[model samples]
Target: MSEHFEPPEGGNKKVALLIAVLALMLALAEIGGKQAENEAVAKNIEASNLWSFFQAKTIRSTTLSTAADAMEIDLAAATDAAMRERMQKRIDDWKKTVARYDSEPSTNEGRKELTVRAKAAEHERDNLKARNENFEIASGLLQIGIVVASASIITGVVILAFVGGGLGALALGFMGLAMFAPHLLF
Candidate 1:
C-alpha cells in the first residue's frame, strides 16, 4: 500500500526554510572540509619528499668533501707528477660537485633550495589544516542548527526557530572565514 501524508494545517513554514538553509550550508562545509583535507595531505607528502631529497644531497656532499680532503693530502705527498695531477683533478671535480649540491639555484634541487621548498610546502599544509578545522566546525554547527530547526517543527516553538537561524548564520560565518580569510584568527 502507498501512504499519503499532508503537512499540518497551521505548521510554521519558516522552520522548514531554516532547516533547508542549514542543510545547504552543511553540504558546502563538508565539501570544503574534504577538499582541504586532501590538499593538506598532498602538501605534507611534498614537504616530506623534499626534506628527504635534501638529506640525501647533504650526505652525498659530505662524503664527497671527506674524499676530496683525503685526496688532497695524498696529492701533496705523491712523488709522481702524473699521480699528483690525477689526484688534483679529482679533488677539483669533487669540490665543484659539493658546491653545486649546496646551492643549485637554477635547478632548485640542491640542499638549500630543497629546504626552502619543503618549508613552503609545510606552511601550505598548516594553512590547509586550519581551513579544514574551520570547515569541520561549520559543519558541526550547521548540523546542530538543522536538528534544532526540525525540533521547532515538532514543538511549534517560534523561539527555537530563531535560535536555529542564528546558529546557521554563525556556521556560515565560519564557512566564510574558511573560504575567504582563513589566515585570520577568530
Candidate 2:
C-alpha cells in the first residue's frame, strides 16, 4: 500500500488567533498608558506652577507687611503732622495690598486661590498616576501573552496558547478597571 499522509491539527490556528487578540490588547494598553502618563506630567507641571505662584505671593505679602511695620515705627516717632499723615496713608495702602495678596478672588492670584489650585492639580496628578499604573501593568501582561502565544504557535502547543489567552483576558480586565475605577487597583 502507498504511504498515507495526514494534516496536523488546527491548534496552530488557534494559537495564531490568540496571539492576534493579545497583540490588540497590548496596543490598547500602550495607548492608554501613554495618555495617563501625559496627563500626569501635565498635572505635575500645573501643580508646580501654582506652588511657585503661591510662594511668590507669600514673599510679596511678607515684604509689604514688613514695610508697613517699619512705617508704623516711623509714624510713632514722627514730630510733624504732615509726615505722620503721609506715613499713615502709606501704611494703610500697604496693609490693603497685603490683604489683597492673601485672598483676592478677582485676580485669582492670591495665596489662598493658588494653594487651592495647587492642591487640585496634585489630586489630578495622583489620579493620573493611579490610572497609568494600571495601564502599565496591563501592557506588561499583554506583552507576555503575545510572546507566549507566539511561542505556542511555533511549538504547536494548544495548552500554552490557552494560558497566554487567559493572561490577555486578564490584561483586558485590568484595562477596563483602569478606565472605570483606577483607584480600585491602587
Candidate 3:
C-alpha cells in the first residue's frame, strides 16, 4: 500500500505573512532603539561637560575666598602703612570678585548660573536615559517576536504565530510610548 499527504491549506502562507509583519516591526524597533541610545549618550556627555564647568567655577570661587581671608589676616598684623593700604585694596577686589562668582547675571558664567545649568542638563540626561531604556526593552521584545514567528513558520504551529503577534503588538506599544512620553513609564 502507498500513502500520500497534502499540506494544510493556507497555513504556510499565513505563517509567512505573520513572519513578514514581525520582521517589519522588529526593524522599526531596532531603529527606535538606536536613535534613543544616541540621544542618551549625547545628553550624558552634555551633562558631564556642564558638571566640569561647575567644578571649575567652584574652584575659582574658593581660591578667591581664601585669598581674601589671608589678606585680612596679613592686614591685621601689618606695620607698614603703604603695605597695609595695598593689602586692603587687594582684599576689597577679591571680595567683589567672589561675590560676582556667586551671582552675576551679566556674565551668566557665575557659580550660581553654572549650578543651574548643570542641574538642568542632569535632568535632561535622566529623561533621555529613561527613553533609551524603554526603546531597548521594545527592541528586545520585537526581536523575540521575530524569532518566535520564524519558528512558527518552520513548525507550522498557528498558536506560536499568535503568541509572536502578541509580543510584537506589545513592543509597538512600548515604542510609541517611548516616543511620546517616556517619563510615564519610568
The Cα local distance difference test for each model comes to 0.90, 0.89, 0.81
| Runs in model 2 lying further than 4 Å from the true structure | 1-9
* Residue 96 of model 1, lDDT score: 99
The TM-score obtained by model 1 is 0.92
| lDDT string, candidate 3, 152-178, tens digits | 767766778888889989988888888
- CA lDDT, candidate 2, residue 64: 96
Model 2 TM-score, all chains together: 0.91
Candidate 2, 148: how far from true, in Å? 1.4
Best by lDDT: 1
- What ordering of candidates by lDDT runs from best to worst? 1, 2, 3
Model 3 regions more than 4 Å off: 1-11, 78-82
Q: Itemize residue pairs with steric clashes in candidate 1.
A: none
For every candidate, C-alpha RMSD to the true structure in Å: 4.7, 3.0, 2.8
Best by TM-score, which number?
A: 1
For each candidate, how many residue pairs have backbone atoms clashing (under 3 Å)? 0, 0, 0
The per-residue C-alpha lDDT of model 3 at residue 82 equals 99
Root-mean-square deviation of Cα positions for candidate 1 versus the true structure, in angstroms: 4.7
